[model samples]
Target chain A: MTFFEAENVSKNYAGHTALDHVSINVKEQSIFGLLGPNGAGKTTLIRIINQIIGPDTGELRIKGEKLNPDHIAQIGYLPEERGLYKKMKVGEQAMYLARLKGLSKQDAYSRLKKWFEKFEIENWWGKKVEELSKGMAQKVQFIVTVVHEPSLLIFDEPFSGFDPINAELLKQEILKLKDKGATIIFSTHNMSSVEELCDNIALIDKAKVILDGEMQSIKQEYKSNAYELKVRDLQKDINEILPSSFNLKKIRALNNCQSFVVELPGNVTSNELLSQVMPHAQVSSFEEILPTMNEIFIRKVTEAGRSK
Target chain B: MNKIFTILRREYLSRVKKKSFIIMTVLGPILMAALFVVPVYLANVSDREMKVAVLDETGLFYDAFHNSDKVEYENIYMDYATARDQFEELDYDALLHIPESALNNPNSVKLLSTSNIGLNMISDMESVIQKKLEAHRLSLSGIDKKVLEDIEVDVTINTFIYKEGEEKQNYSEISYALGLISGLLIYIFIFLYGAQVMRGVIEEKTSRIVEVIVSSVKPFQLMMGKIVGIALVGLTQFVLWVILTGLIVFTFQTINPDLFKYKSPEQQMIENKGLTPDELAVQQENLELSNDKANSLLEGIRQIQFGNILIMFLFYFIGGYLLYASLFAAIGSAVDNETDTQQFMLPVTIPLILAIISMQVVLNNPDGPVAFWMSIIPFTSPIIMMARIPFNPPVAYWEIGLSLAMLVAGFVFTTWLAARIYRTGILMYGKKASFRELFKWIRF
Candidate 1:
């Protein structure tokens, strides 16, 4: 079921358009990756979801109801430029934010204590935020973001300041939250993390969503017709044996096998290419090469720029 | 509303908990009390009796100088040269000399001290000599001293104002003081708490915490909560100052009852000395008249409709603060740091500064056109109208009501405009803010 939906949302600042007809749907218990380059209107869309700014045109619905102020209690937002009151104590600041999210003082305190204990930084509760190291502050911020147990949590560049170990720890925590049936809108430029955790994504460029769908399906759709083949004991050159429809892109010789990268033209099947190469050399292994999210992002953004 | 309260609580608690806030709250009244007590104490401690020796060569002013708490005079029989040589043995502060030609050369009389002669001592000598000279001339013209005394006249004007066909006593001096004080007070309050609102906004923006905050609550709520929170802080400080200053002054009065009294017993004693029955009767009547003036002043103050002035004061106080604070918050939002706020600060502060600068004009001519228009214009009304409240023939009901209504509308309009600018300005970063850019944000 769709947990949050922004339909045809558009926003303009002064005379400049920040977002135009931008829309994204986040499903319950799924992680939605909001992918975009800087100033691509992704932040604007997230802000609209958070209700920090209203869309000039279009509507937002959460769980089949029109989004309103009460829904703010159910949504937690960790902005890209995240910060805590530096002069305030760690636990006090967390309690304050959690209370702002509609948690009672007692509940905020207990939940904050639990999060602080789990993060193994319970001693930091009394320490001011300015006293914490950058990594430590990031961990505290992550805990604060999720402490209210909000049904929908939005984290923008959540792992920007984390070290590898803490980043992995945060990833596990986010996955655990999703397991507990929370909807997540994850916005970042880190495509590797998107590939690892996102179930669906929308890539926005220049105020428009250029690409969006289920992660795997979108990756599948973006894959070119290319395959990597390993063959050994060849009787003839593989390139000479293949028809002109199969373009051999690169060849690399290993100790026991020769690797061939072949691009198949339209209407050409992998089976046909395998069969054509099999007669000339024994095919040890064959695999289709799908595009990485990074490659797809670069390609789509570049294409959008050129078209513009 | 609950969210705004939450934000207000945080804003208020965070600041009130600061060490600086606590220190200032305690120190403010002590400093104010010191401003009063220090000068009085210094004056009392430094006042010393100076003794002057008069050497009158004309020998016509032997009894002219009178002894008082501040100065004493003694007639000397020695000549000027002998007195100058005997000054060390005489142990007197100064030696006065009069040449025989001093009858025509009035400036020939000289006072010489080993150290610098105080101007007070010189004035005392000149006045005594002048009084004696006048008496001598009056005698030469065959004029009686009693006649000269009877010819002196003193007149005082008693002012009254007719309000609603009833005659009421009016004290223009008291009204002038009251108006200036209340007007200046409002000006101080608006600036003190308004800048606090601006600094609070700038802190949130520079620290990057505004985004995190606005996500949960509306920007308008945050801005208002902060402004109201700081206003509460200012009120708290002012109340504490009033209470503490009162306590301090009261304690000092109790310890030394004569600290604030204007007249000393010695002065009364000197005035009563050598007064004939008829002269004493006139003096007693004059004293009673002065006492009646004081009583009338008190009665006038009691009848000045302080209730109306107080109600209007509170209305303008809140109205004026809200208007300026919202604008300050908007300016803070548009700037990245305190330094960048300068360009925007001037325009917002100009109206308040103008109101303060024009207070003199209002006080000088409270019923004039300049005062009337200034009191009606919302930008300057908080101060100008407050100053006109205690004046003669009082500010009209419709004028007060109209000014107040306009103030409410003005604040509402500025708040709406400021909220627009603040919402957009907080989200914009790293850009120098200008009036044109702020205008753009207002449109946004």
Candidate 2:
């Protein structure tokens, strides 16, 4: 079920179009990756979802209800340029943000305590945000974004300033949030994390969604018909055994096995290719190679730019 | 509404808890109270008695000096050279010598002192000598002094304002002071609190917390929350200043009861005569209606409608603050930092500055064209109207009503325009804001 929906949302700033007829549906209990390049309207779309700025045309709904002020309490957003009041104490700032999200003081305090303890920064509560390291402040920001237990959480460039270990920790916490039934809209230029964490995505380029849908399905759709095969022993030449239609793209010799990649024809199937190669060589392992989200993103964005 | 409250509470508490806020709150009262107490203390400190010795070679001005509370006179039966030689031993503040030709040349009399003698003492001696010389000349002409005194005429003009077919005493000077003071106070408050609002906005914007904040609340709510929050701070500071200043003045009055007394010049002169009660009554009778002018001035103060002035003062202060604070917030949002606000600050501040600069003109002629138009223009009305309100022929009710209505309308219009710019500007980063860009933001 769609937990949040922005339908045909168009936003124009002065003379420039920021978001043009953009639509995004965030499913319940899933991570929706909003991938785009600089000035591609990703932040604008995220802002619309957060209701920070309204779409000039179109409507937004949360849980089948039209988005309104009350919905503000249900949505928590961490923008790319997010920051705490630098002079405010970490714990106090967290409580403030949580209360702003409609949490009671007692609830905010307790939840903040739990989050601080979990992040192992309980001692830094009295410290001002300016006193915190970039990674630490990011952690605090993430905690505040989710402290209210918002059903829909949006984080833009969440892992930009985080080290690898902390990024991993954040990824786990994000997965845990989804497990707890919170839908997240993650906007970033980081494609690797998208592949690892996102279940659904919309690739927006030039104020339009060039690609979107289930992450697995997009990868599946964009995948060229190619497979990597590992042979322990080859009795015949690969080109001689395979049909002319099968194009061998690359080959590498290993210590105990020969690995080669082949592109299948439109009429051919991986299983058929495996069957045809089985008699000719010892096929130890065979698997299809899928396109990474990074490649798909670049190819789609470049194509959109060219088409425009 | 709750969200706005949340934001307001944060904005207020964050600032109110700052060291600077605490410092200003405590220091502002001291500075204001000094304005009330320092002058009174200085005047009392300078009221010391001085003694003068007169050496008259002409022997025509004996017993002519009158001694009051501040100055004492002693006549020395000796030549000017001897008096001048004995001046330090005599311990007189000054030696006043009258030459033989003093009757012909008034400037022939000289005063010699080891230290600087006050101008008051010099003037007193000159007046006493001149009166004695005039009497001497009059006696030579065989004219009676009492007859001459009886013939002296003192004319006084009392301005009466005919309002609503009724005569009312008008104290133009008092009204001018009241109007100027109140107008100046409003001007200060608007600028002081308006800049605070701007700084608060810039802090939020530069720290990049505005986006997070606006995401939770509407930009309008955030802007208003800040404006209202800082206004509360201003009000709190103002109330503390009033109370503290009142306490200081009250304490001073209790400590020195005579310091606050309104002693008229006639009363002081009568007391200086050292006459018995009967003689004082006769002197007061001879003083004529000139003494009534002083009493009537005191009465004019009591007759002034202070309650009306106070109510209007509050209305204008709050109205003016709201009108300007919203614009300050808009400018703050448009800029990246305080330095970047220079371009936008000039336009927003011009009308307020104009109102302040035009206040002098308004006070000079409260009923003139400049006052009338300025009091009606919403941008200038808060100050101009305040200046006109305290005048004798009071500002017309319709004019005040129209000005207030325009002020309210102007506040609404500026707030609308500011909100549009603020909502867009808060989210826009990196680029410096210009007037054209701000106008574009309003359209957005």
Candidate 3:
């Protein structure tokens, strides 16, 4: 069974529909990515899943039962807006947050100390939260959110303030957490991180998912039949001898060699473009160009916008 | 329940442990005492050498406005114009310009000073003029001043209060003390705990911690936990204040032996029973008339019963706090920010202010129609009942019972209303809502 499923979930803020007829399944122990641009309702969907808010329409099921208050104990959410009480000490604040997530005082303290020690922030325990750096405070928030060992963890822009080394450190910790049987929903605009971390992605735009599949499969589905061919070009327009299905997009000539990009139309294969391009110019080498996840994200979103 | 306890412990410890809280708690009484003492000290300090010129045009007040010790009177002023000029030039602290007609009319007195008038100068003028007028009237009636003085005008009436089921009683001192203690307790707790609820709501809402905490617990639980915890904290502080005050006074009483006056000259052989020499000297200097009144007040106090008043004060104090704190919590949740709280705050504060203003009326007329009805009303009962407790009360038991019931009923009803608002309001944002909108949300 899926760990959680949101069926036909809909939410509206005033007259503006934040999410419309959206449905998705999060499987157990998988790192699922929610990829979307700004104002794409990712945070709204995350809030509904966390039960921080209720959907205006539709139902959410946790494990095999309908969602209830007890299910909140199983979900650990880190929202984009980080907040810590400025007047409280870091350690006391962490313990207070942990107890809210269902840990006893002693348990919360022990678990929080372990996390703090792991993050090498033991010396910060006695300091007020306002005294800490942004990254340090975020680390405290991260520890509190995870201290109860929740089954599902949702992080919204979790790596925003960290330097590269600390980002890598947090990345390793995420992987370690997943290995310990936790389902992760990591939402971010950083495509490189998505490429490294996410196994499944649902790209949302305009309050709806425009693309949903495995990361690799979705990337493959959006690839264009374009090729880069290095050739020794004898000057030619290269549009002639090709059917309307094939067109040359770019041509770059070096001292003795040339490189060119080819495009194909409907039902046209990369082989057809390669075969047609070879006759027009002396092709040195040819290869098909698959789109990057960043390109796919941008293209899908822009296409979604244009369609709207 | 355990979650509530955890929340309470966290609230009580962390809040009370703050540097601000500790300093305020420890220094609050000291500051209040300083507030009482500093004015008297400053008055004594700045009044060491007051120089005034007196111009008595009708010769009616030449020596009437006598000056001695710290006050020096110069009789050189001849007219109002000259006095006004010297006053504006800061020649003296003030000029006493008693117009010729003012001494005969008695109500035509006015002080022309450069800067401003003060209470001491007004009282001094009234006392000296009234004494001279009395002496002049006596002399005109062909009576000698010494004969009139020996004739004694003081009236001493013995007031005996007896009840069918109780003994003869004197209630003047007990009533005054009861009103003072009760009014202060109600005033202090309402402010202390009401602000606690406001600060707690603001803290959780501002830190965005309310979002996560609300996921696991209902908004009502969070609100109640904060209110109860802070109530307990207030109670703790009060208990500590009481204990600390008692300890400080005890230390002063047991160690110094110079502070308090004792009534019995016959109990000196009983050792710890009588005043020391300095305390006796101070008591002797307090004058015979005031000492007789003090003895009767002490007798009256011993005749009165305090047991009912203590119970009534506890009930009304807690009940009143719970009622007002609920409203504060509701207001805190409704507006999303403190700036908007003022609009709702005025309604809650009005009743408290009215009750305080009517305290004297309640004390003077406990069984009067106004005090009776106000005491039965829940909002005014906390202070009204306290102020009435000392006046041999004549308070009916049914009134106390009915007031308690109404307060309890009011508390429950308000808690439900506040819970409904808190559940919705804590999550609402952006738009400034109308009362209609807030009421509609309660229904939602």
The numbered model that scores best in DockQ is 1
Candidate 2 CAPRI category = medium
A1-308 per-residue lDDT for model 3 (tens digits): 48878888898865488898888888888888998998899988997887767898989887878988788778888877657888889998888878877887889888998999999999999999989888888888888878999999999998999888888988998999999999999999999999899888888887887888788887777778787878775466555656765667887767898776777775888777667666667877888877888999888888878887
Tell me the lDDT of model 2 at B41. 71
The Cα error of candidate 2 at residue A151, in Å, is: 0.9
Candidate 1 per-residue C-alpha lDDT over A1-308 given as tens digits, one digit per residue, 9 for 90 to 100: 99999899999877778888987888999999999999999889988899999899999999989999999888888888877788999888888888888888999998888888899999998999999998998888788788888899999999999989999999999999999999999999999999999999999999999999999998889888999999999998675898887788899999988999998996888999988888788899999999999999999999999997
Per-residue lDDT of B1-444 in model 3, one digit per residue for the tens?
A: 666776777878877887877887777656554554455445444454677777777676765554544566776546777567666565776677667777468777666556665577678678877877778778888888667655756676765567777656455657777676778678778877897798678667666677667766667778888888887777767666655665655655566453354434323322322345754454454456666766887787776666666667667878888888887887777776778788878878888888888887777677888787777787777778777766764577788788788889878887888887777677655445667766876785
Query: lDDT of each structure?
Result: 0.87, 0.87, 0.76
The TM-score values for the models, in the order shown, are 0.90, 0.87, 0.76
Which 10 consecutive residues of model 1 chain B have the lowest summed lDDT? B261-270
Which residue pairs in candidate 2 collide?
none
Candidate 1 clashes between residue pairs 3 or more apart in a chain or in different chains: none
Predictions: Cα RMSD each: 3.4, 4.1, 8.2
Candidate 1 local distance difference test against the native: 0.87
Task: Predict model 2's lDDT versus the native.
Answer: 0.87
Tens digits of per-residue lDDT for model 2, B180-254 = 988989989999999999998888888888888888878898999899888888887777777887887888899
Q: How many steric overlaps are in each model, in order?
A: 0, 0, 0
